[model samples]
Target chain A: MNITQLPFIKEIYGFLGHDLVAAVIGILIILVFVPLNSAFLVWVERKVAGHIQLRPGPMEVGPHGILQTLIDAVKLMSKEMITPKLADKFLFWLAPIVIIIPAIVCFVVIPFSPLMQVREMNVGILLIFSFSSLTVLSILMAGWASNNKYALIGAVRAVAQNVAYEIPLLLSTMSIIIMTNSFKMSEITAAQSPVWFIVYQPVAAIIFFISTTAETNRAPFDLVEAESELVSGFHTEYTGMRFALFFLAEYTNMFIAASMGAVLFFGGWHGPFFPGLIWFVVKVYALIFVIIWVRWTFPRLRFDQLMNFAWKVMIPVALLNLMITAIVLKAL
Target chain B: MIAITDIISPVLVARGAFWLMVTITLTGALLAVVPRNIVHNILGLALAMFGITGIYLYLGSQFVAMMQLLIYVGAICMTYIFAIMLSPPLELELPKRRKAKVITAFFVSLVTFIVMAQMILSYKWAPVTSLSRDWSIETIGQQLLTRYFLVFELISLLLAIAIIGAIMIAGLVRRKN
Candidate 1:
């Protein structure tokens, strides 16, 4: 039977028969997947960082400290939530929720494999970028609501950094979209099956990778949460689950950026001797590993240097790459 | 989870969502003008922009909706927040409450709203005969570069000028300071 032809549950308690059913199941799956994936990534990152520094990471909680993050999660949940006395109460609470929602919503449009996406949005790439940009607003809110000078400075730096990096990120991505002629994630991935964009557009790939790192506030660009400088930056006053939520959003955003990088430049979900889902996961994790490697390997750039790199170097290069892609596409 | 679809049909669901978006937009508009705090006002503007994005989605333009979210909520709202933060604190500048001015402003706004509503209600709106259903990004791009080429170039020029002027003004202010 055609699923679209299924009868609507006319009764209040009637079963969800078709599209709604699929949507509900998708939401449930995502709800389970986001937190689990983020938790695992946290564990992996710690292990990777430790090994990079020639040390063994957490080994007490679970095998090779695999369950350490879960234990930390529990501890964070039980901690007390503190609101600064002079903070704007409404915005202080709203910021964390805002940050988390976009992080999860963008996941719906991310195509893991041909059959594995919550919603194959028509403009999936744009949707993800747009929603991801909301992270800046939340950081600003968190900083301002904390009523701390350090937090405010951190938030300002974050906003400036994000705005500066987003241009090159979008421009580089635009080159791929021009090549693929579609904003849908699945199409971008499918076009990459023969030869991934990284071959033709090496410069864009590099620009995209660098900008994604900055966009996610990963290492070198993580001046927003520079512990040594700003006393934990924007979330200086947040404690308990509130702070945990911010952390979860950050990690999940990193995952999204990596996945996007995989889909855009690398041949996503395409490999020999493995199922498409496995291939997709492998590519994403590989990108994530590189990001982690870069995070721990490189020293953070100064604020002025970061800004100059984006505006002076990345943007102009991306624009030139985009123009070349357009001319080549037209000539072909 | 139980399916409440029997009680709420698809049409009902869509209508509910539409009304919710409208309510959000209206509330945000109210908050934007009514809020005493500059931060609240900026947030309200962002909320309204979000609501408008939903409306654009319903109008079958996902690309425009995303652009709306990106440019207005992401870039413009952040700029406003940064400006507000850099400026003097609200507490330092006490606003003088004038009952007569408030009343006059309210009266003017009310008259404008009524006139606009009346005009909209009386007008016999007709759907365009040659409505193109091509809401794709490609079509939009082609149209902007082809049919709307001059307008597009003009808009870009305007934006470039505005940005340069802003920077020049800021530089002058910094020198004076």
Candidate 2:
């Protein structure tokens, strides 16, 4: 069903027109969902981390620390916003907003179900990748504006890792694109109604997953915010909500990356009995859970080792997989 | 009091957004030129690229617009910043200008501006009565492979050679050390 056909939406569309109504509704969903979804993910991550370490995390806020992230967000909001005397005032303030808008804007193209999604652009996957790249710029601004050496180092490391991993990420994704012959997220999903891409292209799926983990700065690739080493990395100088914005954007990015993985490999919104939206959510969360599990399971790789792994191992493997898929398809 | 809806109607809002993007592009261009700080210049260029992407969207090529964002805003600008930020600041200050040189530069820029403005004013913008052009990604991909295959491969070869040259230069420096 067309969203404009809905009674309330139709009323709004009459008053505001289709484009305005769509923009307003999208912004509303982003504003409402970003915070709540991020908070929930924070709670989940902490809980998962705790369980992995054989402990219960944050039990005091509510039963099993259910309200912990909410309280934590309040605490962060209430704290002082500090600007270092040496900092570049304009870009320093711009960093968090820059990081966030793109993170949330990515949801515009994400197909939660056949009926859902803010807008279905033709180049859905490219749009997401484009916005994710903007996040790198925000990190650069954050690191540079702060005028801290460690922050700069962390930012530089993060950029290098992201840029390196992005190659393999695109390569793996290209293989899927080759198979589907389309870039629209829903179309890609629909193409897999018969059999999931994971069954056909397992190698691409694994490479894609690993590349996404590094892309999101999740452990053991969490060198961007490595607490023990770089004192929270590029966000070392950020305080209160400013720091929390980065935290929130990180989880949202994880969600976006995981959702892409789900759509590409797991036959998005495709499953037995349950509706499309539920299956989609289940797949997204399942991918996210494995990521979090991997985070706690492994130790962080060394800087050189990380670069080597991306360039030497991941790229060649992903490229070989792409070529093999292409030849196979052409042969068929 | 006058009604607010008259001033802020949906039609006006869409036009206002396009104008906003135009203003952003101009501001970013000015920032890029005026700023003495290299980092600020990079940021401005990045911002301008975003504005240009918006303009591309309005011009009816979503594929090109997204590519502008992906290649320029995302990858290229970030690389430019990384190149500078990771190194010590360069001595980028302009030297004391000679009067003749200043006059020459002024005339060059003025002539360039006049030529561009004249071309823009002379050209006619047709009303978009039909969406005839298929600006799809697949069409573009096919065109590149079939029509522009040699040109694409040449560019790729050039980039590969440049990369090798850069590596050789760096290795030479290390050997000298």
Model 1 residue A158 lDDT score: 92
TM-score of 1: 0.92
How does the DockQ of candidate 2 come out?
0.35
RMSD in order of candidates: 4.2, 4.9
Q: What is the interface RMSD of candidate 2, in Å?
A: 9.5
List candidate 2 stretches off by more than 4 Å.
A1-16, A19-23, B1-18, B90-128
TM-score of each: 0.92, 0.90
Clashing pairs in 1: A9-B6, A10-B6
Which residue pairs show collisions in model 2? none
| CA deviation > 4 Å runs, candidate 1 | A1-17, B1-7, B95-119, B127-132
Model 1: per-residue Cα lDDT over A118-141, one tens digit each: 778778999999999999999999
After aligning candidate 1 to the native by TM-score, how far in Å is the CA of A278 from where it should be?
A: 0.7
